[model samples]
Target: MTRLSAAFALALALALAACGGQPASEQGHADEHAAAGDHAEEAGGHSEEERHADGGGEHTDEQPSTTIPADVAERAGIEVQPVGPGTIADEHEVQGLLTPIEGRVAQVTARFPGPIHALRANVGDTVRAGQPLATIESNLSLSNYTVSSPIDGVVTARNASLGGLADEGAPLFEIADLSRLWVDLHIFGADAQHIRAGVPVTVTRMSDGKTVETVLERVLPGMATASQSTVARATIDNADGLWRPGSAVKARITVEQQPVELMVPLSALQTMNGEEVVFVRVGEAYQAQPVEVGQRDGQRVEILSGLNEGDQVVVEESYLIKADIEKEGASHEH
Candidate 1:
């Protein structure tokens, strides 16, 4: 063969080989891309499963809670108490007044008609029994005689004057022993039927909310003319002389006492998500727990469900925890 012919043939062979190799390289790159896509699909599916298993998926309705540091809780005045059994007093409330006991009042008067010579005791003077209150010259005896106090008490009234003609059996001084008093409570309607002698009663001072416990001494047979309500009486000691007559008071008559299984203070209850809940402490986190309630008294309520014994329940300032959780939810929404 000629030399130029041989060179042309070699160049043609080389060009054909190069074209074939280019197609193979393009196919290899395509296979690599397909393999990368399969690996990427597998990795994406695994990642999605991991998110669901780890509880980072599209689930809502998680239990609401808030994390508060111990110092912050103290500063917020949040208090916690364990729930346990207690008593619910089935009590009826009524209004009443403190009155001096009957038969303890004495009205002093002149034993005999005379002209008053000298008056010694005046209104508001404390006197002992048989103490001389006035001196007078009796018209019949034509001599000086002393008019004495008949009882030991504070002189509530004095109607006599010096040198005045003393009238017989006319009230000169009114004395009353106020060491003990009677609580006159007015009970009405069906409540009167539940109350009777020997039941327990709690008398509270309306002015200061001070309370004293006593038993019903008697229920007067007739109704009070002013209110037509049944009159119930209980004796109370006033040794300190703090209780005064004519002061309005509140009374609670315990008709029955019911024993309950679990109880919590009414202050422990809070409203969250339109339901009554109590903040329960777990570690540094407080969670709201819904509860079923039953019979209740003024200070406490019966917890029927959603609580176990020894649960540390927030008893004071629980609303602070509720507000914290609500604020957190609002921020998340924003």
Candidate 2:
């Protein structure tokens, strides 16, 4: 009985040892699989990091810059001008109309009331002083008398026709000498206060933008009833007869001429990222230089900061550069 009991205990002990050894072997294989998986994960992480480094190498500069070839800039009509000193004329813009000088106009009238015998002039006809314009049959003398132009001018109106009755003191022909003209600029509200005689005025014809520089002749005593504006007069030469009377024009009255240390054309200014910028060129790249500006006039502006003398600034077609830079930035964001 004792031997049987001892044999049972020994068999049980052997069975327990065998079960524990099998579990240890299975655990060793599982640990090896886990280590291999960790190594593979580490290698994959290194590959991902390498790919990121390669992508970074291809990255562009985040600064506000545009690359434009010289040929491209020329083709785009982009004009670059060096920053320098210039005169910024403090000009006040006002609307105006061209008129014939009052002293140069003539009203040809019949000396005595009668029937027109012969009409020799028509509208747009050029005539000289004392040139016969028409012949009138005087009622008092019952004789034909010749009427003559008193001044050299172009006929602007012909009130008397052939065989028409003419009245004494009534204008029969209106003539004007167009060699010189008066630009009647109307200055409203505050602009009239700065206006005075002898100030330089630049008159631009609204039709074709033809400009003529002249001096302010005078300011009328009375305000214009229709516009409630002061009338500033300037004389412009019209020997070519291109500036017609009664044509609307724009006048830039330069009240002050100030020489600035650095100035650029108004076209050189552009807006980038909600700030005023001027594109400065260096080689093939244009960088947006934020600038603080001073006084500005009709054609030019004073540069207070962010620019140096002789810096080549893009004065024309700068918007094109701005567009290209923004497009590149957008593509990078995506």
Candidate 3:
């Protein structure tokens, strides 16, 4: 009885111990799965936080940058210059006509009215003073009439012909001194005061395209009765016979004087806000400077202020530069 009872009791105890260890192994496996899930969630949240803090680094590096367009700069065509001093002359241009300086117009007349016998001088013929122009045979008995030139010049007009009646005070020929000529200038009433004797003058003839330089010789005391304007005379040397009488011309008279001022070419100046301005080059850029102007000749202009001597200036194509600067300023405003 003792041996069989011991064997049965040992087997029952072993079976009960095996059944108790099964629940503990399943609980340890469930705890391991929950811990793995928590660790995975924490790691995913930390990765997302880092990405947000970095602000999408690769995309931020790819943002676009601003730059000046080459086409705009090309169209602008900007130019720059500096300030300087130069000579400037103020002159006035007036219209005029040419005339003989020293000459005599004579009319041929016969003591006894008769017909022309022969002709010596014709129109446009050069003759010396006192040279015979024409001869006439009178109807009166034993009479001969001879017409002569009164000055050394070209014969501008002639009316004597063969067998033509010779009458008193009849114009046979007109002679003019071709060596020297005069220009009759008409000045307005207000400008009359500016013109005087001995003022320098330059005359340009329209027909032959010649320019003659001279000085004002005389000014008529009274104004012209027809035009109510004063008349000024300028004498010119014409030894080359380039000038002719009765030719229309243009005369420039220097009037005002402005001594020793900073000057620049007329092309160097530009108008800005109703004031004259110039672009001064400065270190790969340009600065606009306002300037005051005084007297001006044909090509140069007097600078009254806002400039110094020995400053480099742009003479050619300055207007184009001004336009570019204005366009750039407008673009900045927009």
Candidate 4:
């Protein structure tokens, strides 16, 4: 009986040992799983750090700078104008007409009541001073006298046809000298009061986009019935025949002018980050500098700050340089 009891106790001990071995093996596997999870978390943290670094590079990459070749600068008209004193004003644009200069229009009229016998000059015909334009038979003397142009110009108007009867003081032809012209602009209400003679005027031709410089010559009396505004006239030189009478134009008038110590071209100004900026030339590169602007004329702006008297500022095609710098930054980021 003793031997049997001892054998049973030994088998029971072996079974308990086998059960303890399974728990030890399970604990080892759990530890290995926990270690693997820790390693995966470390890898995820490294990836997040790399992503943050890449995001930070996006802003750091954008640097405002560009190099332009000499020929390219010339072609782009990227010339710099130094800050200097100039007349600055608040300008207003008005529609205008290019007309013959005052006292330059001529009318070929019959001296006495007569029957028109012949027509010599037509509209658009260039005629010299005293050149015959028409011939009419006088009613009193029954004799024909040639009506002539009074000035050298292209015929702009004709009131009679061939063999048409003409009364005394009747216009036969109208001639005007186009070499000198006047820009007639209209000003309304309070604008007429502000705009006076001697103010600068810039006339832009609507047909070919040509520009001419002139000044306000006169402010005529009352409002015209057709335009409902007072006429303001400025004399423009038309020696090149670029400006024609009766052609439409736009005129920029300086209503008020004041001298400024330091002024820059208006074209040099650009908006960046809600601030007015001007690109300053430094060797072969352009650096954008913020500026405080005051009075502004038609083409120039008063620079109150951020520029010196002799600092070179780009006056044209500055947008091209800004585009280049942005493009480079985008490419680098990609």
TM-score of each: 0.78, 0.79, 0.64, 0.67
Top model number, TM-score: 2
Q: Which scores greater on lDDT, model 2 or model 4?
A: 2
Superposed by TM-score, candidate 2 places the C-alpha of residue 144 at a distance from the truth, in angstroms, of 1.7
lDDT of 3 at 49: 36
lDDT of 4 by residue, 280-304 (tens): 7766567677778997866888988
Query: Highest lDDT among the candidates is held by which one?
Result: 2
TM-score of 2: 0.79
Better of 1 and 2 by TM-score: 2
lDDT on C-alpha atoms for all candidate structures: 0.80, 0.82, 0.66, 0.76
N/CA/C clash count, model 1? 0
Please give the distance, in angstroms, between residue 225's alpha carbon in candidate 1 and its true position after superposition: 1.4
Per-candidate clashes come to 0, 0, 0, 0
lDDT of 2 by residue, 1-334 (tens): 3434533443343344334432465456548757876786787743433544554321122237755556546656678999999988888989989999988999999999999989999999989999999999999999999999999999999999898999999999999999998899999998888789999988999999999989998999899999899999999999888999999999889999999999999998988789888888887778777788998898999999888999999998777667666765565577
lDDT-based ranking: 2, 1, 4, 3
lDDT of 1 at 233: 96
Residue pairs with colliding backbones in model 3 are: none
